[model samples]
Target: MLHGSDTKYRMFRAALLRGRTWLTPVCALACATVGASWFIADTMVERIAMVGSVLASASTAVFFAVQLAREVNRRNERLLALAGIVETTGDAVVAAKLDRTITAWNSGAENLFGYTAEEMLGQSVQRIVPAGDTTSLQANLDHMLEKDGMHTYEVKRQRKDGSLVDVEITLSPLRDLSGDVVGISSIIRDISERRQFEGEREQLLERERDARRDAEYARSLVEEQNRHLVELDPMKDDFVASVSHELRTPLTSINGYLDLMLEDDEDFPATQRQYLGVVRRNSERLLRLVGDLLFVAQVDAGRISLEMTAVDLTGLVADAVEGVRPVAEEKHLELVADVEPIEIPQADALRLGQVLDNVLSNAVKFTPAEGSVSVRAFLDGTHAVVEVEDTGMGIAPEDQARLFDRFFRTAAAGHMAIPGTGLGLAIAKAIVEGHDGTISLASEPGQGTTVRLELPAQSGSTESARYVETLL
Candidate 1:
């Protein structure tokens, strides 16, 4: 398995030796016969032998000449094929001398530069190079001359029509038989369209970067606004707490005087007594509203402290049902209580009671005459569960989601002029959650409402609450 170069070398040597093979042997034989004929005194035979030797030498020379001619023809064919390829290639192929004078130019070069080979041959390569770029071009050529391989660069060149063309040129050092760099051979390609495409791609990339910058700026603005809101939340809570505390002192005095006036009917006339009753009722409502606001403020500020202790949930439910019984009786509604004794080992009894009272009162308040409001208390797994189900006018689906939002009143309650501050459920939820519990409601419009309270049997300690506040 001879390699390509080895096989060609072997074939060339075989061709060179083909004429010498039999001719060398024939010449040797003729000389031997001539020497033998001289001993036998045959001059004619010697002369014939000498002529045959001459003929053999001439034949050998002719054969060698024919072999050399064949070798030359093969090399010329290979050169013709290379020339055809260079002539037909799409890239401009040009060969220049060390002096920067053009030696050969292909048809591609002609098409690119609008100059035929006849017109460009022997001309200085600088003729096509833009005047502003000659220094850079010379530097590249100098580098190619110093190096052994190829050097490629982009250049702006002028065509014969004086139009600028973007070209990418690869310059390689052309070597002679002795392996010395003699000239440079270059392959040039027109890259105007490629340059245009690159420009468009860069523009698109820049636009994308700009859009990303704008989005980042918008996000930063939103984040800043969120930070401001977070800072202002506690301030708003503080303001509500301060305002409620300030109003509570005056409200308490007004309610007390009104109660005193209403209780004493001898000093006050009938009309005066009625006015005092109205004032007292309105004053009590205002006082309740202020208490609710203060409680909500404390919850939001994470300052609502709970005294955790073991307590019977059954007793709490019973008391809460009794507390709301008078309101249910006033509306002629039935108040039913089903209590199963369950002890919460760790809980805020006061807060838990408050949650129940809020829920039961709401049940009694919303139920119409003869409607039943059922309160159930039991143990569910590790939790103490309290459910208040009422045959009241239920909340709409849209309103149900925000039922526990502070100061959010339902449309039906507002239209009916029901006495409410809408802060009951919100405060109840805060109290329940502060004691490590959850409160949820399920209701449908015109159907009924069910409020379920689930509290952890073993509530979190004060230290855990402090840690939660710190996180907030």
Candidate 2:
């Protein structure tokens, strides 16, 4: 006595064994009708008697056959729908036997490989695999058999046109009703564009690395050159200092002898005295140049020593004015001094005098005859301020920025042949800043020039003063 489920199972098994075709379903329907009629005839013939019994059995057989046919039709409809889905997909769908021979090809396969189903079916799958990639394909197949389900991998495949393409393939084992592996069904997608993009990205990264290496090498070269310049700077300064010292003694003797000769005018002729005056003037100019060079060397070597003491800032300005007054008179330029009585708590009086002398002399030298130079001193907040304004050939705007650089002269001064070593303002700046002070300039090319010095009311600490002196 078979259960209903067992009966259906047996029927389906028998149908499958016969093959899934139009004739197989028809044969199943006929077998079902015959079995129903035989059972009815044996069981109900005696109960219903004669003609009525035969009619009931015939009706029952017809009903069973219709139901069986409907069931078969429903199963066939589902299978056909699955086949349609596999055929219409965009990726190539292939079925192959375990022996690696192609069993089925769909429209997608035809479009992708340029091969028609008629040409590819029953052909070896290796026809599409590149020669160098066959070993890898074989290994993948072996792995799929051991896993017994589904596997995916990437490979290079040859097209029907003999061109190679990168492809990703997913393989699933096909099984029979008893769950035995029969063949493999594969889904293949072309990935040539993706692989090309990856290759280009790798190339770009390598270029970036090369560019970075080149930039680092250039930076290292620049740094090395800078270090060499720094090392050579001190040696140059020392050489200048040594040569200036050697020239100083001879220049002093020449100037002294010229002055003595000019004094003995009665013993010398008048024309001779004029020539001696010219020599004396030039000798003095050379002496000033040598002095400037020595000062610069001392500043560079950090050897400047200051003797600090209390001083009257007003007195210093008045004395510097008096010292430059003779030169101003010679040019017929008026010299004005507006001195305020301010006591500097600590200062190097001699060095402060030198700073004022340098600034005032420049004002006198550059000012034309009849032009006026004024010196003003005052106290502002916690700082002492001194200003020197001159009606002179003012510095050009471009040259003004480098005015305090050693040996830097203005273009106008050079054009006029105004004799100068161009170290006046530079030395003044160093002295002022050494006392923790600031010096600034304001000028216009045609108008005039004004210089301002601002000093702390109290001098900087001794250590800071020394540090500033070294920097100067």
Candidate 3:
């Protein structure tokens, strides 16, 4: 905002005292001659009048030209001021000297480069530009001088803090009135944030692709495991019979012998008893595996029926805890429950009971001797929070992110070979979420793990009426 009164807007020095024109003396002589000849040289008077008129006309024309030039200069000054305001008002304005010195910088440049004009001016342009760009910047300037019009390009510039930023820079070479080359003026815009955001988006896309690849790989592995499962001891007789009709006829063949031996049990040998025991163990393991596979299938298909009923949450916790107490005691681990005295809205009692059983069983399995597993449940506002915290070989940060993923076992979990179908937690998650709940985990390597479940409290029920009890 240069005021009209400001020195910057003042008339140029060239306008100040352009010494009276070279012919001023000649014009004065003409005037004096005309005056002297008025009476004495009447004949010469016409000649003098003619000469005076020509000189006066010439002077008038010169004066008008000077006035016009002055007006044009004033208008140009106003335009320069407006342009300066517009350029500096934005984030980046740069001026480089003919000698490669950074001469002028604007507010936007300050923000982008983290350097004030005082620090940058008079310094070689390389002082702030990255070392790699120094040669390029010099070559650009050389190319600019040879090539005429304004040049626009992008450059990577280094900030005062030594961070790199992408800049959309447009350079225009300055010129004198005679069109002589002067220097360069640039408009720089910081595009670092934009570049970073784009990079992040690309990274997320890569992660998504990797996740899909990993999932496809896992599906192949599961198919292989299903083959192994075909031979393992099974729990459901009908399913086994349905699976392998060839084996069903053979299993019937084995059943006939079992019946014959049991009927004549009086003379069964020790070796035969041992053989039968091995067969029985294999059969049971296979059946359990098959049952898990089927249950998981039902969960996936959303065909599992849930019978909703009113059940005391505290009572359920106690029952699950009591059921697992002996196992925890066998490991010499302490199992503690802190179930609060608040009831929740009506729920599928059996489904929720199974959910508790699965969670506690996992906790006990992972916990070592003398280690503790804590089950804490309470109603907070409109949500029931259940936390199964255990002192065990905790999950790693990278693995914790996918802890709820089906069949996902942490490295620690694999090394220990903890007995699990791996479907327990996944099934628990499906059941809890069916009731609109969220499950989360907080764990650190070697510290412990906490699997927390938050279920929304029944909206309109008298949950506060019944007393809740915890600890089994």
RMSD of each: 11.3, 9.0, 15.7
lDDT, residue 130, model 2: 81
Model 1 weakest 10-residue run by lDDT: 463-472
Q: How many residue pairs clash in each candidate at the backbone level?
A: 0, 0, 11
Expressed as tens digits, the lDDT of each residue in 136-220 for candidate 1 is 7788987876676899999899999999999999999987655988899999999999999999999999999999999999999
Task: Write down the lDDT of every candidate, Cα atoms only.
Answer: 0.77, 0.77, 0.69
How well does model 1 score by local distance difference test?
0.77
The 10 consecutive residues of candidate 2 with the worst lDDT sum are 463-472
Error of 3 at 174 (Å): 33
**lDDT tens string, model 2, 240-260?**
888988889899999888878
Give the true-structure RMSD of model 2: 9.0
CA deviation > 4 Å runs, candidate 2: 1-134, 140-204, 219-234, 265-286, 318-337, 357-375, 388-426, 441-450, 458-472
